[model samples]
Target: MTSQTLLSHVASILDAAGVKRGAIHDVHTNTHLLRHEVTTNLDATVYRPLFCLILQGAKEVGTSAKLLKVRAGQSLIVSHALPVVSRITEASPDRPYIALVFPLDLDLLRSLAPAVMPTFDKAASDPFSIFRRDMDEGLEDALLRYFVQCKAKNTRHLLAPITAREIHARLLIGRHADVLLRLLWHDSAASRINEATREIQSNLSETIVVGDLAQRIGMSSSAFFEQFKAITGTSPLQYQKDLRLLRARDALRATRAKVSDIALRVGYESSAQFSREYSRKFGKSPRQDRNIAPVEQQQCIADPAPR
Candidate 1:
C-alpha cells in the first residue's frame, strides 16, 4: 500500500477499536479521537501525559493567560498539569478532526537515551515544558502503526513497548527535542520543576508549601518559583489548584458522593470556594457539570488555540 493509504488504514484501525471519545487504555494504548467537530465546552478528569497529533482541522487550548493553536498536521504536547480552556477551531461535517494521543513515559526516555546519539544543546538548556510541533509523514506513519498494533491485544503484548520507543526516538529528532531533553537533565530547571510537580500531583489534597518543595528540589524560593513558571507556564500554586480541580472532576464522575465532599477531598477548605474556582476553570460549576467529556477536549483546553 502507498504511504498515505497505510496511514488511512491505521486511522481506521484505531477508530474501529478504541472507545468513541474519552476513554482510557492500559500503559500501552490509552485514547484516540476519531475525526469529528465538537461545539460544546468541556473539562477532563485525568491530566494525560501524552502528545496530541492532529491529522486534520484546528484546535485552541487556553489557560489563564496562555492560548495556543494547533492546526492540521500539527500536534501539541502539554508536559504539566494545567487548568485550561479549549475550543475546536477547525472541523467540518465531511472531514472531521482526526487526532491521536501517545502517552509519554519518563522511564522509557531514560532507558532509550543511552542507545540514541545525544543531539541536545546543553548551553541552551531550558526546563521541559509544554511543546508544539508539526509531525512529518514518517512520524505520523509510525504513530498510526503503533495504534494499530495496540488495537490488537496479542500484538500489543509484544510490540507496544517497541513502538513506543520508536515514537520517542522520532520525538528526540523532531522539532521539540529541547523541551523534552531538558526534562531529563539533572540540573535543569525543567527537571527540578517536574520533580516538584510530581510531589504535588501525588499529594493534591495537602496544603502545599512551595518553599518546602523548592528546598526539596534544591532551589531557593525565588529561583524555584521562576523555574517552575518557566517550565510549567504557570505558578506552582496554580499548578496545585489545577491538580485539585482535576481530581475533583474524577470524583464527580466516578462516585455518587456529594460535590462538597469531592471538593474537600481535592483540598478545598470550603465547598463554595471549590465551586467558584471550578466554575471559573470549566465555565460551569462542578455540581452543574457531572460528566467528563472526551480526553482530547479536556487536554486541548489548557493549550484553546493550538500554538
Candidate 2:
C-alpha cells in the first residue's frame, strides 16, 4: 500500500544483509534481493516462474518481441521459462534500484487451484506469459509480513511456510489470478504452451519437429505455432535456441569443460557456429565468457540458487 514505508523496510533488511549490488540469496526467507547503484547495459538471461517486486528505481525487461518496464511499487510475474534481454534504466547511489524475486511453485499453486473459484474467461486474453502492473496492496502486505516473520528465528521455520501458502492463495484471488488460473487448467492455450516449453527444456539436444510436437500435444502445427508465439513471445525454434545458449553460458561460467564440448552438450553441431551465436547473444565468445565466468556467475536471473 504505502510504498515508502514498505520500501524503507525492504531497504533496511537489504542493507543489513550487505547487499550493495547484484543479487543476494536470503536463505532464511527463500527469496532474493537485487540492487544496482547505477543504470546498466542490456543483459540476457533465462527467467523462471517467479514474481519480482520492484522496491526502488526501475528496469526494462523483454523478450525479442515484447518489453515491459517496472518502477518502484510495481511487480512483474514471469509465468514460464523465458530468455529475456533487460537493462536497468534507473538507479543511483542514493536511490539504488532494488527488487525482490520470489520463485513461484507451480505444484503449490496447482494444489490451491481447486479451492479458488474460476474466473469467467477460459484463458486470459492477453497471450503473453508475463504480467506487470502496480503492486497489489493485499499481496504487498502479506509479503512484508512474511519478510518480518523471517527475521525471528522461532517463526521463520514454524510460521513462514503458512505465510508462504497465504501468498499463493492471494495470487489466486488477486489481480494475478487470471493468468495463473489459465495455467491451472489442463487444456488452456497457456497451459499447452507451458507443456511445450517443458518438452523443449527436457530435450534441448534433440531436434524439434514442430508438427510432431503439436500433434503430441493435441494441436495442429499451425495452431501450435501461433499460440506458442502468442504466449512465449518467441517462435518455438528460437525459444530452444535461446535456451541452449543460456545453458551453455551457465556451463562456461561453472565448469572447465572444453568450449566445443560444452557446445555439443547443448546440441550444437558446430563449435564455430555455437561461438558465433553465443557472441551474438551475449556479446562474447565462448572462451571469452569462460575467462570471465567467475565474476559473471552472480546476477539477477531466474534461479540464483540453481539446483
Candidate 3:
C-alpha cells in the first residue's frame, strides 16, 4: 500500500475505534493514542526515550539547534534524553492529528542493530536521529498493526513489547536507519555526545560543569566541545540550558510555586537570567507563560499555526 493509502486506513480505524483526540498526560505505558484538537502548544517532555509517528497531520520537534518537521508517514526518534519543543502544525475538529510514540528499549535496539545491514549516512554533517521522511509502506504497515494490537487491553501486556521490537527492527532498515544506528554505537562522536547528553539529563536540577563532563567522557575539553556540536548540532552548554528551561516549565505547570522558586530549582541562581532564557526558548517569560491554560488551547511559538 502507498503511504497515502496506509494513512487513510489508519485514520479510518482510529475514527471507528473512537480514539479520543486531545493532549494526554499521565497516560503511561510505552505508547499513547489520541484524536482531537489541542491548544497551548505542548513541548514534549524529555523522553528518557521516545519515538513519534504521525498518521495524519504534522508536528515539529526542536532539539538543540535542530528543528525536525514530521508529518504523516514520517517518524521522529529520540534515543537519548533531549529537551524538545513540539507543536501540532496540522489538525482540526474534522481532520485531527494521529500519533504513536514508543519509548526506546536500548537493550532491544542494541541487540538488533549489530545483526542488520543498516544504512549509515557517510556524510558527517547531519547530526540528528530523526527519520523525517522515507517511511515505506512496510514500516507503516507494521506500525498500523502494532497500534491496533496495542489497543486490545488484554493482549497489550504480553504482545506490545514483542511488536515494539519489530517496529525498531523495521526502523533500522528504513531510510533513517543510519541516524538511528549512530545513536546506538559508542565509538562515534554522535554516540559519545549521546552519552554526555544522558549525564546532563540525570542532573538537570544541579549545576553542570561542562569541563568536568568532558573529562568524565574521556575527551579533552576542546575536543569534547567540538564533537558535541558535530553530533548533536549544539554546544554542550546550550544543550544544558535547554534541559534546565524545560524542567522549570514542567514544574510551573504542575505546581503553584513561585516563578523564582522554580528558577532556583532548575539551577538558575538569578531569576532574571532564567526568565530571559526562558522567554528566548519558549517565546514567553516565566511569569507571563505561567498563566495556566488547557492543553488544547496553546499553539507552538516557532511556526505560525495553520488556519
Candidate 4:
C-alpha cells in the first residue's frame, strides 16, 4: 500500500480505539500511540532512542539549537537521548494529530551493522542526533503489518519480533543509514559520543567534568568537546544540565517528594537554583501540578498536546 493509505489505516486504528487525545502505551508491541485534538503550548521532556511516525497533522520539535517541523507521512528518528521542547502545530477535532512511538534498540542496531555494506560518512560534520524524513513505503508496510500482528494474541510475541527486525533492517538501508551506521561503528566519534551520553545519563545528578569524560572516551578535551556537540547538537555540560532538569521534572509530577529533595536527587545541592532552572525550562514552578506533562516512557516531547 502507499504511504498515504498506510497512514490512514493507522489513524483508523487509533481513532477506533478511542485514543483521540494524549498518548496510550501499546502493551503488546511495547510502543506508544499518540494523538491530539488541538494545537498546544510547548512541552519539554527527554527523548530516548526511538522511532516516531506521524500519521496526521504536524509538530515543531527543538533542542537548544535545532528546530524541526514534521508532518504526516514523515518519520522521525531520535538516535540518542536528548532534552527537547515541542508544540503541536496543527490539529483540530475533525482531523487530529496522530503518530506512533517505538523505542529503538541500539544493541540490536549494532548487531545488524556488520551485515551491511560500509561507507565513509563523517560523523563529526553531522550535527544532529535527531532526523526527520519521508516515510518510505517499505517501512510503512512493515510497520502496518507489525501493528496488525499486535492485534492477534498469537502473533504478538511470535511474528512481531520478526517484523520488528525487518523494520530495523529497512532503517539500516534507508536514508538514515549514514548516521545510524556511524553511531554503531565501534571506534567512530559518533560511537564515542554515544558512550559519553550514556555516562552522563547514568548519573545525571553527579558533577560531570568534560575533561574526564574526554579522557575516558580516549579523546582530548578539545576534540571531545567539538565532536560531542557536533553529533548531539549541544555542549556536554548543557546536555547534562538539560537531562537533569527533565528527570527532575518527571519526579516532580510522579512523586510527592519535596521539591528540594528532588533537586538533590538530580545532583543539585541548591534547591533554589534547581527551582529557577526548572521554571525556565517548563515555564512553571517546580511545585506546580504537572497534569499536562507527557507520560514517562511516551517520551514524545516531540509529539505534544494542548494544555
Candidate maximizing lDDT: 2
Ranked candidates, highest TM-score first = 2, 4, 1, 3
**In candidate 3, what are the lDDT values of residues 1-307, reduced to their tens digit?**
5555545655555566565555332122345444555422655445445566677778777664677777777776665565555667888876678765555566777889887633555454566544466467777777666655656776577776677788888877876577777777667666777888877766767777879988888888999988777655567778788768867876787788999999998889999899899998877888777865535322221111110
Alpha carbon lDDT of each predicted model: 0.66, 0.83, 0.66, 0.79
Per-residue CA lDDT of candidate 2, range 261-287, in tens?
999999999999999999998888888
Candidate 1 lDDT (Cα, 0 to 1): 0.66
RMSD of 4: 3.8
TM-score of 1: 0.82
TM-score for each prediction? 0.82, 0.94, 0.79, 0.91
Rate residue 171 of model 2 by lDDT. Answer: 88
Alpha carbon RMSD to native, model 2: 2.2
Sorted by lDDT (best first), the order is 2, 4, 1, 3
Q: Give a tens-digit lDDT track for model 4, residues 242-268.
A: 888877877877888898888999999
lDDT of 2 at 214: 95
Q: Which ten residues in a row have the lowest lDDT in candidate 4?
A: 298-307
